[model samples]
Target chain A: MLNYIWIGLILIGLFVAVGNDIIDEVQNPYRNGEPFVSTVLLKKAPSGIRQTWEGDLVAPPDYFNGFYGTQRTQEPIRQPAVISKSADGTASLTMNITDASPAWWREMAKSAGSKERLLGRVVEFSVSEDQTSARVQVVFESIRFVKLKAVTQAALDYAAIAVNIALGLIGIMALWLGMMKVAEEAGLLQVLTRILTPVTKRLFPDVPPDHPAVGAIIMNIAANMLGLSNAATPLGLKAMEELNKLNPKVGTATNAMVTFLAINTGGLILLPATAIAVRAAAGSSNPGIIIGTSIVGAGCATIAGIAASKLLQRLPRYKKAMEV
Target chain B: MGEFLKNLVEVISFIAIPLMFLLFLGWGLIKKVKVYEVFVEGAKDGFNVAIRIIPYLVAMLAAIGIFRASGAMELLITVLAPVTGLIGMPPETLPMALMRPLSGSGSLGIMTELMKVHGPDSLIGIMASTMYGSSETTFYVLAVYFGTVSIKNTRHAVPTGIIADVAGMLAAVWIVNLLFR
Candidate 1:
């Protein structure tokens, strides 16, 4: 009956995926290649001490060109900067604004009605004089505001790809888990459960070592440790459900279940392939950081998880349960 | 439509060619492989999982779009600026952080923009790249995992996943500071 249910779910999931247009949308690439041009006009004073500098930045030129690809009068202005040019073309002019109160970028963004506000206070400028216009290279030393919308957008795009890949793995693992369920119904899980009896006894003192819940917990943890998080979740839930099934009366948390959740949550595994793939996709110069960090982070999380679980088990309620 | 076709061609040229070669190698090394059967089975599975998570994916995508449309993400960066400064992260990285959770391609676009804006070697540009490589989409993971298992208790998962994300974010900043700053 369970086997049939599993197969049915898989079939239904597949049917829906093909029937819907989500995949097409996800797989479809969006072309956003619009030329952006920023111009700053500066008028030089005769002595060159400094006069005035004004600049305008145009982002996503396509947006300025209306939906019909025609130019519009009111284009979205991203960052506007005003600076003063130094008297001598060689000297840099610095502007001090410490007495002025600095406002939070978001507050400014609210008034501007945009997500990002131009950040940077003018620190200095280098001027070059020509026949018609004085060209100045303005240096912006610090940002007053930073907007995360673009970064978050990038993260989401990466996650979409990751989710797609993870889903593929989940589909395969679901098949494997289903097959494993068949093995269990045929008594394979029981045999494995007995083989693991000693460790299970030590690990889960609150639950009877021979309980079906123990087998389920072991299988669930095994799946999680393999980095198949989606596959691990259902197995872990089923284990908890089976454990609950054993408790005829339940008002308190069990040491075994609590410990199981902690371990499953902290399951340490390396996904170098995924990390490297993401790095390559994101155009990283070094992809090895994924490998190095995973080893360190996963190691720490796993240890902390074990320590937390052990400490929780030592609590008075859990200690008393163990004693019982 | 032409752009879409061009993108399709680029994807095929970039991803499909390499994957096809890898598949060929696998087939040559393995004995008695039912190539067509395996291909059909894999495709069927991919199609299935994609369908099962459609609503969740759509919700996430739409939420991302709205956030972009509404300028909430930009607001978030403004809110985080002081903290970002204390950590020596570039303000330009704001967009990359916002885009990372919603879409990979979108993040790539942001990263490309950053590279153009900051010349890749700039501290913020490097940090943005690092963060891009370091973190995962917690919400997307939650949606897909829960959507597939039909488990609704996101109680512990959401908090834990976000904690990991914060840690990843800090790590990216700290590592960049140590290496570059």
Candidate 2:
């Protein structure tokens, strides 16, 4: 099943990318003009009064010399403008430029790797537009074709994703799983499972009362709830091994194992530490805001998982296996 | 109230780390379970697990990248936008939702990209983060767990897991709209 899915994804992706590329090629408006942003208007607020100045670049400046309109002369194209706030601070200065040339409206686009130009241009502005100073803003109105190159690049970028994950998981998995090992040996898992036994017993009827697998199942769920994913896997695997001991059929998953897998896959995270970190890295103001939502969503998912597994196990096809 | 809750959460996190460490060490000592050695024993298994899932990880990640690049994802979102929009899920988040169950890194990458495009404080960004945390990588978990035990006939697990994923996505949309909107 996984094999077919993998192949299907790859084939579908190729077909779609090719079809989109052809359409973009035929429909792209920017194909006729070199994407450029040669003219920039610098607006400065000196005192309460707002002043506007036109900053002109050398006409037909070398586009290949480097971005920011920096020609081969290596001289700065536009001199630095100083800005100061008014004493009253009620007035705001803004640039109002009306040039429809797409070149004048070029915006920075993110590209993969060091050569960001592979997809598009990311011009580094050398202007002093600090917040403390007069707020400097760029106003250019131009249009460009949708960035299609990135789609192709991002497809092959998966290898890098795999490599990055492979490298990162080493330390993370080691530390968390090691802590879990200590916790397990110290009987912390047993303590947790004891607390969750009533719920587990209700969830897994096939597992006999007083069975060790019940404790293991509860431990797995508890680890996941604490956002201890590293520990959850080992405990989940351990639980599966225990449940398998009771399975009459070796290769086929038993009812208990399926139920456990469903719950495990549904997620039981109380705190999503990793997602918060990602948001923080992305410079979010409130990285922790998702915590409440995550808990609620995971709870709903877990309920759905349990309900589905219970309903599915009662089906006629599975009834014979249950009777056995 | 939100500010107070945030601070309380911060305090719990600050305390939780050290508390967990002490709990393990003190409990291990009381149980006489050679905490250091047991830790090493478990830590060693990490390398084995990482190595074991390398193929699965690489295969899934590669497929995800191709799928995203192929414009198929864009098409999928476009096709499903009306339905998802009616449910308050932005079209941009469809990739993350679809990919969340298949691959962990895949969904994480999509979520990161989405957050980058939309400021993390934006409604879309909050929704993505909530979705990211609310569901497990169902297919990846299934592969690793069942592969470890060589379970060939995984009956009913896939459908159950997918149902859970749908429930998770819905809950994420509803909850984020309630809390952050």
Candidate 3:
């Protein structure tokens, strides 16, 4: 049931987030509170008026890779940082996290105290004899509960995204629905339905051969095959509305609706345009290579879906749901 | 043959809509139907239908989003990786198979990432793209369609969709391995 599946996702997500945080707590992958030793190439020296020193923190790729136990970066890390000593003599380091930062640190920077810069406490700063470079030991601000924070953000973001998606559908939905309305009014649907009766009658035995729902269903499936999704969705919804009229019980699905939805979800398309486009963009030698494979896959899906819908509708539980 | 088929479908897709519009409205004119008034009358339902599905979509998508962001998919792939070899599936594309039925954008992201890491002509890339084309996002269609109709008790629709998704994914794996591998 949707209730169980929905709740399962929420519960599993919450538990996994907590579980991941716990694992992170034990493993300490971020090396929180651990001193990081690296050399800085100082660009600006302290003057009489200012004790702030600005430099680029540099680390060899091998050292970083070894420390993180990851092969995330090949280029050396050279990130700009400012070290300023307070009147009490404790120094703090602020590093602007840029695109050139190691992938691991950039990920940590997302949850850092400052979203843009990584804040760290200078444990020991020893200037080189030439005064142009220094070796520093610094511990970055701790990062924790990453997955949990992401989970919360995603819930909020997806809710807004969902509304945006629906709102965006208004224009396309209106366009297709209007055209479908005209087709229905002009006896065009009846003529098409008549042509597809043998197929529809077998696919949906419970529906009358001449039902308007049959017309919408045929149009919807054709739209789907053509990958005209803007048209398919509106037509499919129209089909659902018409199919609902024949339902003996309100708020429950009939055999015809199940069959129709199965076909929709099967998604038997003549061409997989999105995939092909992406393949071409990704520079495939044969971008349209998946056409045959996709057709075969979708064909199997359609047959399996139609067979499953027919077989499952006969079960006592599904049949019971249909009863008034 | 492939080039011809591609061009043929391209032409059809290009002209199909305009031709359909001309035929439908022109036929309406012949039949004495008040095309504009009838069109506006029917189009009015579009806003209502779009608005009605917002709640269902929010509920479905929010759950899926949480699941995705929690890094649970990675854990799932780790667990399912061993069984992938039994089905002739490249372990890397399992995420595509899993995400396809849940979220359209999520599966697309996986497909693109797979092709980026592996060359587009490689077996993994081809299989991932094929998997993307295999099936519709089942849960999304379920939410939107049933939400529009306000059908709370979906009965066997969920199972039917799951079966279709599984069949589609398996068929993609099977065919891709048969030809490409």
Give fnat of each prediction, in order: 0.01, 0.69, 0.76
lDDT for each residue of candidate 3 in A1-324, tens digit (9 for 90 to 100):
787888988998999999999999999888889888999999999989668889999999898888776786899989899998888889999988888777798899987777788999999999999999999999999999999988998999999999999999998889888988999899999999999998999999989989989999998998899888888999999999999999899999888998999999999998899999999999999999999999999999989999999999999998888888
lDDT against true structure, model 3: 0.92
| Candidate closer to the true structure by DockQ (higher is better), 1 or 2 | 2
* Candidate 2 chain A least-lDDT 10 residues: A113-122
User: Which candidate would rank higher by lDDT, 2 or 3?
Assistant: 3
What candidate 3 gets wrong by more than 4 Å, as runs, is A46-51
Candidate 1 residue lDDT tens string, B96-159: 7656645556676776677566655567666666665555454554455444434333323433
Q: Which ten residues in a row have the lowest lDDT in candidate 3 chain A?
A: A64-73
Ranking by lDDT: 3, 2, 1
Off by over 4 Å in 1: A1-174, A182-269, A278-286, A297-324, B1-65, B92-135, B144-157, B179-181
Q: What is the TM-score of each candidate against the true structure?
A: 0.43, 0.66, 0.96
Q: List the residue pairs that clash in candidate 3.
A: none
Give per-residue CA lDDT, model 2, range B1-181, as digits (tens): 6557656655665566568778878888898998888888877866665555556556666776777666686688778888987888888888889889977877899899999999899999999999999999997787667654567677777778889999999999998888777
Q: What is the lDDT of residue A252 in candidate 3?
A: 91
Query: lDDT at B28 for candidate 3?
Result: 91
